[model samples]
Target chain A: MLTQRLANIVFTILLLIACIWFAVIAQGFEASGLLASSGLPSKFFPQLLLAFTGLCAVIIAGLYLIKGQAGGDSGETVFANFAEARRGLLMMVVAVACYFVWKRFGFVPMAAVMGPLSLLAMGVKAISHYAIVLALTVLVYLVFTQLLNIQLT
Target chain B: MYGDLQALMTALTHLAQPVSLLLLVGGIVLGLVIGILPGLGPPIAIALALPFTFYLDTVPSLILLLGIYSAAIYGGSISAIAVGIPGTGAAIATVQDGHKMFKAGQGGEALGFSLTGSIIGGLFSVICLALISPLLAQLAAKFGPREYLAISVFGLVVVVRVAGKSLSKGLLMGGLGIFLTTWGLDELNGTERYTFGSYHLYEGLPLVPFLVGLFAMSEVMIGAERVLNKIEFSDSSLKVKLPGLRQLSRMKSVLLRSSIIGTIIGIIPGEGAAVGAFFAYSEAKRKSADPDKFGTGIPEGIVAPETANNATVGGALVPTLTLGVPGSPAAAVLLGALLIQGLAPGPRLFAERPDLMYSIFIGLFLINILMMFIGLIAIRFAAKLIMVPTSIILPTVMLLSFVGIYSVSNSFFNVGVLLGAGILGYVVRKLGYSIAPLSIGFVLGPILENALRQSMTIADGSIVEFFNTPIGLTIYAVLLLTICWDRITALLRRN
Candidate 1:
């Protein structure tokens, strides 16, 4: 299990790297035509925010490095147990997978698969749970397509 | 005054329409149902309904979203009292005393107090909103880029200060949120900063999808973790028995104080219903004759938080309506609805749409009044609603979010943005960062960037001129004073 202290420390470090990288990318930003000499460069706000975010990430990293915790978090593990962690991470995978499914296979196919896949990922054993989710998906479909006239495709 | 009366009449005419009345009732019922179900709060509730609003008229859309905002906060307490699990974050403070009272067989009475307090608090804040918003708008009419810069900075700083336990973490999230907003072409220069060759990125990340993803999709992921947890509560004590006038008279002081606290907290940027409820709860306990009895089943304990949380609905609208700044995450979603209607939210909105303003005030008042009848009937069925398993809800909400995001623009890229935002929200929350500042930061990002650049141009490279406005200086002064006062109070309490 990943503890919050270690996770946050690593997260902050990665965030710092992203901020610096973004800042470097920001330097390449240039305005064209008559707007080239604008009031402030387009990079100004993003770079300022990058600097602010980077400074905050550095402070958070230092706090975790020295105190083993930031705020009152007290270095607890991020997930309660293996089962809970698996369910959460698996659901995330299912969601991302369903999005790709929608992209490749269409909305109807994605809708059909999403609920049952989520149920499977959560390790749901109840057959009725899958039925209820499917029913609700149909309801969402009717409401959006028929009632609101939204094109699902 | 006559023009105001005319606007009120026009608003009444709009509300008198059958479609408006039906939606008003439907929104309340839907809000209660969603609120009774745990893990779905006001922001998600409003966001879910947002796509539907894309097809609605402005007044009806605003009315629907406002009803959800007000009732959802009130609805959370029902679960808190009956099931010991707060249906929303706002109801978390109510669980200690509310559930205790339910176990002690005073469930109906506790439910009554929360219902009455919520309506009263909601009505009071609506009154405050009606009175204060116009004056604020009048003052805001004089605001230039410098004043807006000050207000935006004030909003971001205040939200970050209250958002999380770690200031650095909050700041990091706020910065990240604002940075994400910088993805589209710059309005000032038309320079494509990070559009990455997509015209979809021209308008920046779509607001509604990002918001829905952050609040709803993220909740789906987190809620998936405990999908099998069952809720149990007795239905025997579910009936609501409202207090008599005499009993109500006795708690008027608590009700009044909590309404004030909630409304005041609601007007501040980034403070939400949860913060208001906890603040009112603590204040009520501190002033109680028997503070020790607070957590052990007391009516005052239930009344304070429920009232304050509902009051935040009206209070939150003050900034959202008058200043184009959202007072809460839920209000930020409401702001999106305003944008969808092609109406800019700010002092100009008040001047341009006096009838809409009147509609909001009158509609909120009516909703609070109607919530009583709706809440009374709804509480009887609260047990069943509470029992609807999370396993069923998580997948449905996830599907709804997916379908809802796709429906808004019929764009696959927007759906992608929604999924990405959900993952970001999930990671941040799991690692212990509140999404309030992040959501608010995202909403305020364009405003912040515009204000800063404009203020810089207006100041002509002089830093001192940026702080030259009297109103801007006063805002900064008040912000400094608030921080110092909080620190001093904390030190005194520690001592």
Candidate 2:
């Protein structure tokens, strides 16, 4: 019971921190001089949305802290089991890696690593799966580059 | 009327071109392949084709996408009838009777009936589009910002209700989705919102990349979770045994009623093919002499939902092309395509480009006609294609995503966004958040913001004055009635 309550309180604090971050970001921004005279500047809508979202987050956090787990609607988490958590987090890493690789190297290099990297991330096995992935990649390259005439650097 | 006639003439001319003919066939074949594949739907099929459209003429490009849209919905039924797995959400209701028929050794019969029913429903709705779009466009010309606001609100509420388990969760996501659009420069005023300090943020989140990311990229990630699972189903009933005249005559009433139901539901902002289908199925069951025989592979049961669901494609397009409040999520994505082409959907579009509207009507009609022949040949080929390894399909699709999104802006940032959106889509779908609300919310967000801001300005900060318009007030009243229907019925039962 204490552990659950502690979890709720911590989550609420984290949400509150996120709200403060948004509020600070809003404050740090500048609205154009054209709309500066319009009483409600451009920041008005974003600030309003952020504020409301923050308030809701705070309320939800309060509910969790006060009433404990609030009836129903709980299901699988993003990191449910050990295998899933590792895969999800690792996939996020691979995605970032792919993005950077696409940035540094060309699409061809990114394409080469992306399949095997993602496959390895998902724990998919067999050498044939890798061949299938490579063949599929080459087919995509041929169609997009040769047929559709897209310039993929 | 003169403009519509001219547009029809232009469309006929466009269709005469060999490229358009080839594309029409190509799109239908592609749509069939997509529809047979589990976890891919019409939106992904269109998104994959979006980048390619950048290089082509508008007419051929649109015809190709429209072919994909119309045929993809029809294709999902093929899978449902054959393997008991619905290829798309719209075909879920079809699975009950369709798969049952397949299981009972009537696989060819079910496929035939479903394909025939789909064409009938699709053509019927296309006819409705030809007749009714101009009329609805005329009516929508009278709406002001307040009226638009009311309609948008109704859409959002309906979407939230239809989307998922928790109302608050839907609301939160919907709000978050809209709030993201409040970035970039304001349209009404030249002020910057939450653009943070990047030139890329100036345009806010780019529409195509954002959407493709949200729908396609997300789906890919979600597919990763279940990709390893052995999905094994085969149907010997590969050849289509289309219903004859007598069978068609017998199911005529079922076909007509479901078409009407589908068209009406399609007119509503939130409801789409799935809702129309399930409702038609239930109505047929309620009207039937033996309700218990519904899931027992009755032809009426299969026809009612399958036809209605396909009809919904046309029904959903009605408001999308006119009022600009998308009648469905798929229509919302279609709306994004319109915006990309610099075709702003509204009453103005009707007046300025009646020919384009007319062409869409005639083209949708042609697309459905071509779908029948395309479906006949492709369903057999598509079933065999399903045996194509997902390992190959996934990497190829991913590369297509890269090339497609890249070809649009020639930017790697957009591709990253696509991958990001795909991951988001995968996660939320796994979390049971229907991508419909998110997609609709994103499209409707700017419209909602502008309408509300303008209305408030006119109202002088008074909330009461916002409800001043007669059309707007009536729309709000209808929205209230729809939201309260379940609660009112529950209360009556208690009393």
Interface RMSD of 2: 3.2
Tell me the tens digit of each residue's lDDT in model 1 across B157-243.
889989889998998889988999999889998888788789999989999999999999999989999887777767789989999
Worst 10 residues of 1 chain B by lDDT: B1-10
For model 2 chain B, give the 10-residue run with minimal summed lDDT.
Answer: B424-433
Candidate 2 lDDT: 0.77
Q: What lDDT score goes with residue B298 in model 2?
A: 79
lDDT of 1 at B112: 97
Worst 10 residues of 2 chain A by lDDT: A69-78
Task: Kindly report which residue stretches of model 1 are placed more than 4 angstroms away from their true locations once superposed.
Answer: B490-495
Q: Residue-wise lDDT of candidate 2 within B128-151, one digit each (tens)? A: 877787788887899888988988
Each candidate: how many clashes?
A: 0, 5
Which residue pairs in candidate 1 have backbone atoms (N, alpha carbon, C) closer than 3 angstroms, thus clashing? none
Quality of candidate 1 docking, DockQ: 0.87
